[model samples]
Target: MERVVITGMGAVTPIGNDVKTYMDALKAGKCGVAPITHFDTAEFKVKVAAEIKDFDPTQYMDKREAKRMDSFCHYAVAAAAQALEQAGLREPGSFDPWRTGIIFGSGCGGLPIVETEVVRLHEKGPSRVSPLYIPEMIANMAAAHISMQFGIRGESVCPITACATSTHALGEAMRMIRHGYQDIVVAGGTEAAICTIGMAGFQNMKALYTGDDPQAASIPFDKRRSGFVMGEGAGALILESLSHAKARGAHIICEIAGYGATSDAYHITSPDPEGEGACRAMQLAIADAGLTPADVDYINAHGTSTPINEKYETIAIKKAFGDALKSVKVSSTKSMTGHMLGAAGAAEAIACAMAICDGIIPPTINFVEPDEDCDLDVCPNHAVQADVKVAISNSLGFGGHNATVLLKRYE
Candidate 1:
């Protein structure tokens, strides 16, 4: 099997639209969570979100094409274009069409469009619905659009494992390259689910932080944490076999050492309190990487700020790392970016890549109070600069899905 490595990354995130700016904002511990500006919120209990501000999709695609696609697709195409450009694939034919692939995904694609057309159908009857509704509403469009946009003809799998969606994309893409199925892959996830109905659904389930304070809304591992803050964005990464990247003279960012995925089969909406599946996921990833837990330098946790998630994730870490837990520094970027849902895993995976490359760990901001249940060294409120040789990221999704990927600093 060939080794896989990240060649380039791009992001349309709540904090910044590009990877460089996003890394800068993360290192500064900037909070992107703010008031929800996508729609009026008078009748809603949820207030703040990490919304992408002033995004112009025309910057990446044609005006007509941008208008035809949903917001999720817009973000997906923009991020993929940026990643391709950064990886020196600036044109459609830059890579072998049959040897290239894309695995981008969304948790709930075109959710805003779905909400809009449903509203129109209810108020103006079915005849008033836009003919573009079905094309814009499917979750697989992110992958399909990316595949068409970049001439990727090998594979286009789009997974929909709730929050684990994007992490699965990266992991599966890595497998494709590592096992010689594809030479290169554009992999990640995107989401634009901050619309009225999306927020209302999560809020009705008591899964979102209804509090108005942006700083306090998504405080993962903190005693005062309420729940996850709803956010919208996309993240993309270019992955290729180490040999392919080297032969193409690509600038490698980091190595994707291992990937592990498992299902809890325990709950529909919550993780097991003991973190059984989550523990094995991390252990499997570490073992697959041919390393012990002590070799890991940092962990970018799922850390969604929900009480049960934080508490049980802490347990999972303890179970996976044991005494190594005392030395491993962990943080949740969700404290700043809120929960990007499907986009969260790829975004955080990019954070892990940045940490491995730059040796700076982003903080878990607004961590003033510590919960005894979550006693890990969370790198609270400030960035920590250290020589991070290996980093691992965990993404635990609803319906018992858990995924972990390990990254090593490219030598």
Candidate 2:
């Protein structure tokens, strides 16, 4: 089997537009949540979210081309461009187009476009709806547009596993490379669902924080935590075989050591109370990495700030790590970036790779009072400097999808 390594990463997040700026904000313990300015929230119960600021699609692509894509696709392409540029693959012939591929993921794609087109149809006729609506509203279009942008012909896959979408994409991409199917894969997740319907749906489900305080709304693992703050962004990564990266002299960030995925046949919206499926996912990932619980140093948890998610995730961690759970440092970047839906896993994976490279652990900001059930080293409210060698990122989605990816410091 071939070894998969991350060569480059790109992020268009609520806190920052690029990886460096985003990581800096993470290290600084910055909170990106704010009052929603994209739409009027006067009639809604939820008023705040971690929205991307000052993002001009024109900066990434021409206005004419930008108009055709939904905001989700724009974020995906922009992040992919940044990752490709960093990997030195923007130049023609830098890599074989047929040997490279793209695998992007999204939970809710082009919801804004769908909302607009439906309203247009209701007001006028079907003829008034934009002809580009179907193409722009589809979830797989993110991967399709990325493939067209870079001329990658190997395989363009779009996994729609809800919150685990991008984590599944990265895991499946590694499998493709290991199976000799592709040499390189541009994989990640993007989400832009901060529109009216998006907020109303989650709010109605009681899965979102309805508080007005931006800082207090997304307090993950805290006793007073209400719910997750909805967020929108994209995160992209360039994963290449170790030999390929070394042959091209690419700057390798970290090695993807192992990946594990499992389904909880328990519930559609709620995690298994015992965290059986999630625990097994982590155990499998650790076993696949050929490491014991003691070998793991850090965890980027699927701590969505919701009471159920945080509590169940804690049980999962304890069940998986056992004695080593006390030694490992855990943190949830969601406390800072809100919940980026499909993009959460990819963005947190980037943070894990960076943590290994820089020897710094990002903080779970807004964690004021710790819950007894969620007792672990959360790196609460402040970043920590540590020699992190092996890290695992966990993502659990709707429909009980659980995915874990173990990353190791590139040797």
Candidate 3:
């Protein structure tokens, strides 16, 4: 079996447009939640979101090309370009294109595009709809765009598992490289659904934090926590075989040691209250990495600020770590970045890797009045520097999907 390592990472998040800025924002406890600017929310109860800041898609692609794709695809292409560039991979000729893969995914792809085209179809008839609508609106188009942009032609796949989408992508990418199916894989996720209809859907379902105060809205693990605030962004990582990376004289970021996935087999939108599935998922990941609960140093939890989610995830963690849970530091960058939905996992995965590299654990900002149900040392409201050797990121989705990916400081 081949060892899988991360060589590069990229992100287009609400807090920052690049990896360095994102890490800085995390360390500073910078909250990106603010009034929604994508559209007017005058009559809507939910007023704020973590919108991307000063994004210009043309910076990554030409005007004509950018016009053909949706915002989600644009984010995917930009992030992938940044990842490849950092990995010292410029063009198809630089590496073997046949042994490359892309696993970028989106939870609700091109929702804004569908909203626009549907309105056009209703007001101006079906003939007014743009011909590129279907292609740009599909979930798989993000991966397709990344593959085409970089001329990578092998094993392109886009996995959609709601919030777990990017975690699944990263896991599968590791498997592909570790099993010798691909020498390298671009894996991550993107989402741009903070539009009128998108907000309406989540808001109506009571899955959005409707408070007007941006700073106090996304208070993860806090007793006053409500629901998640919508966010838009993309995150990409270059996972390559350790041997392949060393042979090419690439800078190794860290090793993706293990991955585990499971399902609650319960409700469609809620996690198992007992957290049995989530506990097992973490157990499987630790075992797969040839490690134990005591070996984990930090946890980048899927803390969405939702009441039920935080409680259950806490329960799951307690079951997984047992006695070691007392000393382990845990946090949720969502308290700063809002919930990026499909892009959240990949961005959090990047957070874990950066934490290992810099020895700084990003804090769970906006935390106040901690919930008794969530009894853990969730590094609240402030970042701390620690020697982080092993970190795991968890992502649980709407369909009872749970995934855990473990990363180890590459020695």
For residues 58-167, write the lDDT of model 2, one tens digit per residue.
Answer: 87778998999999999999889889999899777899999998889999999999999999999999999999999999999989988887778888999999999999
State candidate 2's TM-score: 0.99
lDDT of 1 by residue, 56-148 (tens): 999988899887899999999889988999999868667998998889889999999999999999999999999999999999998888887
Model 2 CA deviation exceeding 4 Å by range: none
For each candidate in turn, the TM-score is 0.99, 0.99, 0.99
In candidate 2, which residue pairs clash? none
Model 1's lDDT to the true fold?
0.92
- Compared with the true structure, model 1 gives a TM-score of 0.99
Model 3: weakest 10-residue lDDT segment is 88-97
Segments in model 3 whose C-alpha atoms lie over 4 Å from true places: none
lDDT of each model, Cα atoms only? Answer: 0.92, 0.93, 0.93
Cα lDDT tens digits for candidate 3, 231-328: 98999999999999999999999999989999999999999999999998899889989999999999999999998999999999999999998778
User: What ranges in model 1 sit over 4 Å off?
Assistant: none
